[model samples]
Target: MLNGLKTLFNKKSVDSKFGIALRSQAGSYALDKGEDTDIQAGEYFTETSESAGDWLDDLLSSHNFQGSGHLVLSASHYYNVQINKPDLPDNEIPSAIKWLVKDIVPIDPDEMIADYYDSPVIVSGTQKINVVCSHLTSLKKYTDSFKRYQVDLEGIITDEFAFANLLSHRKHSTLIICQQPFEEVFLIIVKEGQIYFSRRLRGFSDVGGYSTEQLSKGICDSLSLEVQKSMDYFERILKQTPVSEIKVLLPVKHENFIIENLDKNTNAQVSKLDLPSPFEQMRNCAASVGGLIEFERKGAEND
Candidate 1:
C-alpha cells in the first residue's frame, strides 16, 4: 500500500559530518551555543516509496553541500512543561501555552503534538521550559517538503530552536519578527539568552499570498506591528520589563523597512541578524553554513 511505502521510507538516517543542515537561507547564521558560520541548507519530508537516506543523499549530491558526517534530528518537536510534583509522567504536564494563556484562550489539548525541554531561567529558583508542538500531519508535511527539495536532511529541528540559536549571542531583551511566504508572520521574544515567548500572524502579506513587492510591504508592516505588540505585552501582562532593544534579521532586500520602522518607533536598536559579521557576506548560503558550523562546534566540544 502507498501508506506502507511512505512509512517504510521515513526511517531515520544519520550523517556524522554535517549533522543535517536546517532549512536556511544562504549566509544565514545558526549559532550552536556560540560559534558562527555560513550554511546552505533546505528542509523536506518523506514521500511514498522514497527512502529518507536515498532522498538525503540525492539532495546533498545535487546541492553540493558536504555530507560526510551530517546528522539530522528528525521528527523533533519542542514544548514546555512545568516541573510539578512527580505523580504522573512528565508528558502529563499540560502545554506551556495552555498554562500561560489558558484563561485568555481555550485550546484543544489533543489537537497538538507537544514536546518539552528544560532550560535555565534568569531567576535561580525557577526553571524555564520550551514547549513545541504542531499539528501532526502538518509537521510531517514540513519534513516531506525537505525531501521534495531533494536535500538530505541530517536531522530535524523546530523553528523555535532555530530562532533561539539565531538569537543566542544577543543579550538584553530582544524581539525577532520574520515574514514567511503567504504573509505569515512570526514574532519571537528572547532575553538572557533564551526564548521567552513568540506569536504568529497570518494573512498579513498579500490578500491571497505574496508577490515580491507585496511581501516586502508585508515584512515592514508585520515587523512594526509585532514589535509594538511584544512591547505592550511584556509591559502590561508579563509586567517584567519590555525589550530594551529590538534586532531584525531578514534574508536581505527588504531590510530597509526594518531599519526605517525602528527609527520611527520607540528608541529600540533594530538591525539585521543575517549579517551580524562582515564574514557572513562571503558565504552564499548562510543558514546552511551556519548549521554545519554549529554542528562542527558541538562535535568539537564533545570530543
Candidate 2:
C-alpha cells in the first residue's frame, strides 16, 4: 500500500515534478524548471490536525498542481533511524528491519511502510544503514488528498534527503545542518552526493527563533558540540575521512553567529548555503525546493 516512498526512479521523468516541503502548520509548493521556479506557500489553521489535508488541498489548488509530484515530509510525520544493516539480501532487508525497529516507533512496524538508504561504506564486519518509515494509515491522508486535487503522488522523502538534493555533489563528504519551521535541528553527511549518515537533534525544534541571549548562553555552543560529535562518529566509527565542508542552511536571523560558532569548534570550513530568489524568500521550503531540483543526490547519472 505504501510504495515509492523513496527515490526509486532510475530514469528521467518528463512530466512536471511538484515538490512540496511540509511542515507542522504550513508548507511551500515548489516547481523548478531549470532556470526559473514558481513557488506558492501558505499556513494551515493553527487548531487543525496536520493529517486532515484541508490546508494541502488549498495549496495544491492555488498552485494548480495537477500531475505527479514528490512530498518531502517534515520530522513530525515519520520515524527515521540508523541501525546495523541486516544480513539479508537487499530486497529482503526492508521487511526484516521493519520488525527490528518496531519497538522504537509508535506505529506497528509490521503494518507501517519502510525504506532504507546506504550509510557510509564501513570496512568492518557489519555496515550501517538509515531506515525511514511512516504508518500507511497516516500517510493515506496525503495520497487521498493528492487524488482529490488531481496531483499524482509520485514519491515521498524525508527532510534529510530533501535537503541533500540542494547540494552539488563532491567527491569528499559534506555535512549539512538544516531546520524547518518548528522542527528540530537535522544533521546529515552526504558523501559522493548521497546520504551517508543523518541525525535529528531532539529538543532543538526551531532553533532559528532562539534569541541573541539564547544563542549566547550555550545554545550555539551545544549545537557546535553536537555537530562536531556527529562528525567524529562518521570519521572514527565509520572509518571515513574528515568531512570536507560544513554548510548551514537555515531561516534564522543570526546565521553568521551560528556559522562562526561551528567554525570555531570544527575542522571543516563552515558557511551558509546560497539560495536563489524564491528560496531565500521562503526559507522554510528549502527542502521542497531540494525535492524539486534534480541534483544527483541519489547517485543517479546526470546524463
RMSD of each: 8.5, 3.6
Worst 10 residues of 1 by lDDT: 1-10
Error of 2 at 235 (Å): 1.4
| Model 2 clashing residue pairs (backbone) | none
TM-scores of all candidate predictions against the true structure: 0.56, 0.86
Q: Which segments of candidate 2 are over 4 A away from where they belong?
A: 1-15, 33-46, 276-278, 294-303
Q: What C-alpha lDDT does candidate 1 achieve relative to the native structure?
A: 0.47
lDDT of 1 by residue, 68-123 (tens): 23232212222333442333455565434444433332335555554455543433
Ten contiguous residues minimizing lDDT sum, candidate 2: 1-10
User: What does candidate 2's lDDT look like per residue over 1-303, in tens digits?
Assistant: 124553332234444566777776556667743335444543444446744577777777766775455777888788887788887888888678788788877778656888777765754777777778887786677767777766666677778878888788688899999887777889999988777788889877767778878887998888888998999998998788899899998778887888888898888999997655566777766877776653323224434
lDDT of 1 at 272: 65
